[model samples]
Target: MDLHMNGGIGEASYASNSGLQRMGIMKTKGVIEQAVSDLCRNNVNFPKTLVMADLGCSSGPNTLLVGSMVINAVTNTSLEMGLKSPEVQINLNDLPTNDFNTIFIALQELQGNTTNGKMRDVHHQPSCYFTELDEVNKGNIYLSSTSPESVSRAYLEQFQKDFLGFLRCRSEELMAGGRMVLTLAGRTTDDPRVEESNRLWGPFALALQDMVFEGLVEEEKFDSFNLPQFTPSPTEIMNLVKMEGSFTIDHLEIFDVNWEAWKIMKNDNDASKMKEADDGVGHGVAKAIRAGIESLVANHFGEAILDDVFMRYGKCITDKRSNKENQSLVSITVSLTRKCDI
Candidate 1:
C-alpha cells in the first residue's frame, strides 16, 4: 500500500503538525553545512553544477527544510571562500502517495529568488517487506519486547536487503568522490528489545491495539498490520557498507533526545498546567501522530472512526507519560562518500 502523511495545511495535516521533524532538520544543519563546505574547498574548483537529493522528502512546510539548508550552506560557503555559487539541482522525492504538490507550490514563490541558483530535476526512482507472524505477535503494529525472536529476525533480514539495495543504487548515481549524508531514527545497538525504538512507536501501536479491543477496528485488520521499521545500529550500517563495498563511512554520530519533548507540558508542580492546556502532551501528540499516520489508519479502517479513535489515543498518551518526564528518541547520522559503482 502507498502510505503518506495527511496533506494540506489544516490542523490535522503534516504541514501544521511536523514540528518534531523540523527540530530534527534544525539539528542536521551543522552537519549539512560541513558537507557543503567540504564539497566546495576540497574540490579543485567549486563544481559549477551540484546535485542534491532528499530521498524521502515528505511534503509540508518542512518539506524543503533540508534542501533549503543545503542551498544556504553552498551559498554561504561560496561567499566565504570568495568564489561563485554553483548552480544547484535538487531532487526531492518521496513515495508516489506523498503530496508533492505541497512542495511544488511552496517553491513557486522562491523559484527565482535571490538564493543561489536552485533547480528541480529528478531522473530516477527506487523501491521493499515483512509478512506472517506468530499468534503471540498478532495485533501488534511493530516489534515489541513480547514479539517473538523470529519477528525481529524477519525485520532485520528485510532491512538488510532493502538498505543494501539503497547503497547499490546511490553508489551508481553519485560520482566517485561525491558525498551523501543519512540521518534516521535507529537503535543504538542491534537488539530488537531496545526500549528506544519501542518507545518511538509505542503510542501508535497502543492506540491501534485499543481500537481492536473496543471493536472500532477489527482484530484481523489490526493483526495484519506491521510497520516495516527496523532500527539498525551504527555497527549494522557500518557492516552493511563494508559488505556492499561502494561507500566508505566518513562520519557517524548518535544523538538522544526526549521523545516528543516539545509537547511535554511545563508543570506538574501546580497541577494546573495539564488541566489548563487540556492535557497538552496527549492532545498535542494525538494531533502530531495522527498527522503522520492518518492516511495509513484511515486507509486501513475508514475515516469515520477517527475522532473517537484519537480521543482514546490522547488519553492513552496522557496515562503513560503524565508522570514520566522523559522518553528516549535516538537518531543516527552517517556520512558516506561514494567509492564504486557497485
Candidate 2:
C-alpha cells in the first residue's frame, strides 16, 4: 500500500465530509433515513433481525456524522413500526496499516452521544465493530473507499475484478432485507477521459508536475506514479452488483459536490509555503490547480508555457473568492444500496 493511500483514510474522511457538505450531500442524508424507515416497516415483527451496516467506515467526523443519521433513520422507523430499534453495526474498515489511533479517537468521541441514538445504554456501548474485509462477517454495512483514482485501461479491468470479489464477500454478510449504503466518486462510463478522471486527484497531479519542473521531485519518480481506483461508473457498478446475484439494488443517484473549499485550502497552503523566499517547497496556488486538471498537455505545448496552462485549467475550476482566483474545485458522489437476501 502506498503512503498516499494509507494516509488517505483520514484525507478521505476530511474530503468526504467537507466535499459532500460543499457539494450538498447533507441534503441527501434524508434518503437513508427514508429507506431505513421503509425497511423497518416491512420487517418490524422480527425481533432477531439486524438492520444496517456502514462499511469502509473511516474514523472521522463522517463516521460519526453519517452513523448518527443511520441511527436516527432506524429509530424513527422503529417507532412507526412499533418495534424495538434494530442494532446498527458500523464497520470502520481500512487496510491493516491504517492509523487505528485516529479512528479510535473518533470512535471514543461517539461513545456517549446519546442524542443521536448510538449510545443505547449507559453501561453497554453501541454495537460498533472494527473489521478488515478479510475478517468481516455477514450483517455488516458496506461503505466504499472515497479516495484513490484508478489508472488506465488495463488496471481498470483488474480493479473491477477485485471490487466484485469484495462486494460478493460483503454481500454474504448482510442479513435478508438489510440495506447497505455505499458512496463512490462517479463519472459516466463512456467518457473518453475515464482513465484520467479522479475527483479527488485533479489537483494533486498538477502540483506534482509543478514540483518536478522546479527540480523539487526527481523526474524519474514521476513515471512510476499511478493514481488509485475510483468507482468507475454507475453502469459498471450496477453490472457488478447484478452479477453477484445475491444483493439486489435499491437506489442509485449521483450528486455533484462542490470541492472549492478544499481546493482553496490546499492552494492557499501550497502558495504560502512555496514562495521563493521560504525554505519550504510550495508551488504557486495557480500552478497547482493547472497540474491537477490537465496533466497531459496537447502536442506542441512545451514546459516553457506552464504558466499559461496553469491559468487555463485554473479558471475552469475556480470561483471568485476574496477577489482572487485561488479557489477552485470539482467533485461528484454516487449513492447506491444493496439489500441482503435472507
Best by lDDT: 1
Per-residue C-alpha lDDT of model 1 across residues 36-90, encoded as one tens digit per residue: 7887888875699899888987777566667677888888988998988888888
| Model number with the top TM-score | 1
Q: Rate the local accuracy (lDDT) of all candidates.
A: 0.72, 0.46
TM-score of 2: 0.63
lDDT of 2 by residue, 127-198 (tens): 222212222211111111222223234345655776687777766766566566666656654442433244
List, in order, the clash count of every candidate structure. Answer: 0, 16
**Local error of candidate 1 at 34, Å?**
0.9
Q: Give candidate 1's error at residue 32 in angstroms.
A: 0.8
* Residue range with the least summed lDDT across 10 consecutive positions in model 1: 266-275
